[model samples]
Target: MSDIGPESAAGKRTLRRALLATRNGLTADDVRESAVALAARTLALPEVAGARTVAAYVSVGAEPGTLALLDALRARGVRVLLPALLPDNDLDWGEYAGEGSLARVRHGGRTALSEPAGERLGPDAVTGADVVLLPGLAVDGRGLRLGRGGGSYDRVLARLERAGTRPALLVLLYDGEVVAHVPGEPHDRPVDAVVTPSGTRRFR
Candidate 1:
């Protein structure tokens, strides 16, 4: 790991593994309780409170939960969008209707993902969102998110940029996953904020 976490490739992999291991150790009850708190903390964000359309996702395995947050956002009349992974690892968007509207999809040799089962909206559909909720393993003080390295959300962010849309980008994570620093590149866009179970952290 580099003395400074940012810009060090090895630092990201090392940190990501550690964070994921900690998450995998969480109990089911722990995940449930944290999800409730995360929902409350994230729902209170001014950007989310004012958003008409929010692009979000479903959490799987040990990731910080998003189902409760998704439901809460929908209850507030926000049009929530979820991603369905394509074969090439790109994403396709679909609206979140409710719990019943989700379907489990298992990619070969990968953890099954719960995605929206409704109409298949084109990928560019995310450009209409007022807020975009990202799923991540950890985030640093400067709002640099450490993702799963799947490059899916990276594509989403690039699409948003190409469309000249600058919606508030947010990541959901466990409280302890908020770290002092994270490795990143110039092309790696820092998020606007990170919502943890305890509170929210905003960055430039």
Candidate 2:
């Protein structure tokens, strides 16, 4: 249990290190259990239930798993869109057919990511989604999200804003990752809600 209080005003680097260190201690079984519960909890959200299209990402390393939810969404005939990382760190969109449709792509020195193997739908394709599930290291009480600092999702949010589109923004994480506050930047965007293995919390 790390203290990520608003008082610390901890810099993004320090907060991310603490969050990532905690995640790294999780066992495979722990991740599996969290993933199962996360799917059940997230699927219950009205936004997810009503979404015609969802833009989500694959779980990598010790992050909360998302494959279960992705599969469930597809099974419900919901159009699931996954991201493919671009050289500039922005994301490209693609359809998630299933586990078989994902390809393992390694980006330089970064961890290999599981991305859609089918046709690329372009980055702007995300604006068409009813919901966008963001992968985050941690979220605070205000629903402010701490991403991997890749600027990829920041681009997505800006793109959506520029398009005058406001979709349900959500983040999935373990309970402990939900804290009192997290470092924020002018470009940082807040999430509408957060889904954890324990349950879901709406910020706005």
The numbered model that scores best in lDDT is: 2
Candidate 2 deviates by what RMSD?
Answer: 3.5
Q: TM-score of predicted model 2? A: 0.95
TM-score of each: 0.94, 0.95
For candidate 1, list the clashing residue pairs, or say none: none
| lDDT tens per residue, model 1, 1-204 | 324544476778899889988988999999999999999998888898999999999999988899999999999999999999999999999999999999999999999999999999999999999999998988887788889888899899999999999999999989899898888766678899998888888897
The runs of at least 3 residues in candidate 2 whose Cα sits more than 4 Å from the true structure, single-residue gaps closed, are 1-10
Please count the clashing residue pairs in each candidate, in the order shown.
Answer: 0, 0
Q: Which ten residues in a row are the worst by lDDT in model 2? A: 1-10
| lDDT for residue 204 in candidate 1, whole number 0-100 | 70
Pairs that collide, model 2: none
True lDDT of residue 3, candidate 1: 40
C-alpha lDDT of residue 47 in model 1: 90
lDDT of 2 by residue, 1-204 (tens): 233455344577788899899999999999999999999998999999999999999999889999999999999999999999999999999999999999999999999999999999999999999999999989998788988878899999999999999999999999999987787666677899999998899999
> Once model 1 is optimally superposed onto the true structure by TM-score, how far is the C-alpha of residue 168 displaced, in angstroms?
0.6
